[model samples]
Target: MTQALTLARPYARAAFALSREGGRTAAWSQALAFASRVAADPQAQALLGHPLLNPADAVGLLAPDGADEAFTRFLGLLADNRRLVLLPEITGQFEELRAEAERVVKAKVTAASELPSAELDAIKAALKKRFGREVEIETAVDASLIGGAVIDAGDVVIDGSLKGKLERLQSTLSQ
Candidate 1:
């Protein structure tokens, strides 16, 4: 995982720079995401590794017709280098750069049960206030949490779940 990230860093930075210069961060984000998804597909993965496939054909497999010339060129470069498998990591890094530029943060919240819309909104509002940036929340239900929620917001993790509390209590009692 670390190696893939290391390999992806330069490409991601280059793509981010291009997007920033062109004032098309959102567009590049979508294109990278789409390409990543395509590259992850089993059939597409096989095609990407096919010895007979040319770089142009590989780019066409991932990119839509009439894509921006810059994006096509980027895809072609990846294809030429046989780095199509790094698309997902590149997309992730690109999103991180985009979020930093836009003053936004992505957070994951896992709860024992589905949170009410109002509750979720309140959580998001609080996160935005705490982080001093727009927070985009992704929620998941984890029955193992037993109760409450655990929030993973960038470098900050708030383990508020019942399971987490129990574990902490156990450790304290042991000590």
Candidate 2:
């Protein structure tokens, strides 16, 4: 994973730069996401690795329909370099770069049960105030949480779940 990220970093940066220049970060994001999905497919893996596979065909296989020339060219470059298999890593890093550039905070909230819209909105408002930036949240239900929720916001993780509290209490008592 370390090596993958290392190899993919430059390509991701290049892709992000291209998107920024073209003012099509959203388009690039979608196209790269689609290409990553295509490249990660089992059958596509076999095809991409085949010695007979050429760069143009590889680009065609990976590029989404209606992709812009710039993005298609980007895919061609990746294909030419035999780096199509790194699409997933590149896409992930590209998203990180995009998020940082846009100053958007992506977070996940896992709770014991489904949260009401009002509660979710309150959480979003709090996070926005805390981060002083636009917060994009995704929510999940985890019955094992017992009660409350866990907020994972990149560098910050807030474990407010009863299960987490009980575990901490137990550890402190044992210590």
Candidate 3:
């Protein structure tokens, strides 16, 4: 992971610089998503390990149609260097770039079950009201929670799940 990040940092920085200048940060996200799909393909993975696949051929294979030319050239560099496997790192870096530019934080919330639309909206509204910035949410289900939800956003975690309460009760009883 460290090596991948190290390898990806330069490419990500270059892409970020170019996209920011054009005010096309979302383009970086889309391009990185496309690159991620290309990197994850079985044939692409195999090709990454092949000694015979030159950079230009690899770039031709990985570059999807409709991609921005600048982004394509950026991806070409990675392909040429056989560093496509570090795509996840590049995505993470690009996300950071977008976040820094937008001043919005992305958050993930895991609950025992699916949250209703109303509840999710309320949460987002409350977060926005408190934080004074747009909050981007990603949610998932974790059945082990039994009930309630655990919200993690940036440095804050609000653990309101039944499982957490139960553990706290157990500790109190034992004490």
Compute each candidate's TM-score over C-alphas: 0.96, 0.98, 0.89
Per-residue lDDT of candidate 2, residues 124-173 (tens digit): 99999999989999999999999999999999999999999999999999
Residue pairs with backbone atoms closer than 3 Å in model 3 (clashes): none
lDDT of 2 at 76: 92
Structure candidate 1, residue pairs in collision = none
Ranking by TM-score: 2, 1, 3
Q: lDDT by residue for model 3 over 72-109, one digit each (tens)?
A: 78877887677788887888888887787798877788
**lDDT for every model?**
0.94, 0.95, 0.83
Among these predicted structures, which one has the highest TM-score? 2
Cα displacement (Å) at residue 171, model 1: 1.3
Can you rank all candidates by lDDT, best first? Answer: 2, 1, 3
User: How many clashing pairs per prediction, in order?
Assistant: 0, 0, 0
Residue lDDT tens for model 1, 73-162: 999999999999999999999999999999998999999999999999999999999999999999999999999999999999999999
Least well predicted 10-residue stretch by lDDT in candidate 3: 58-67
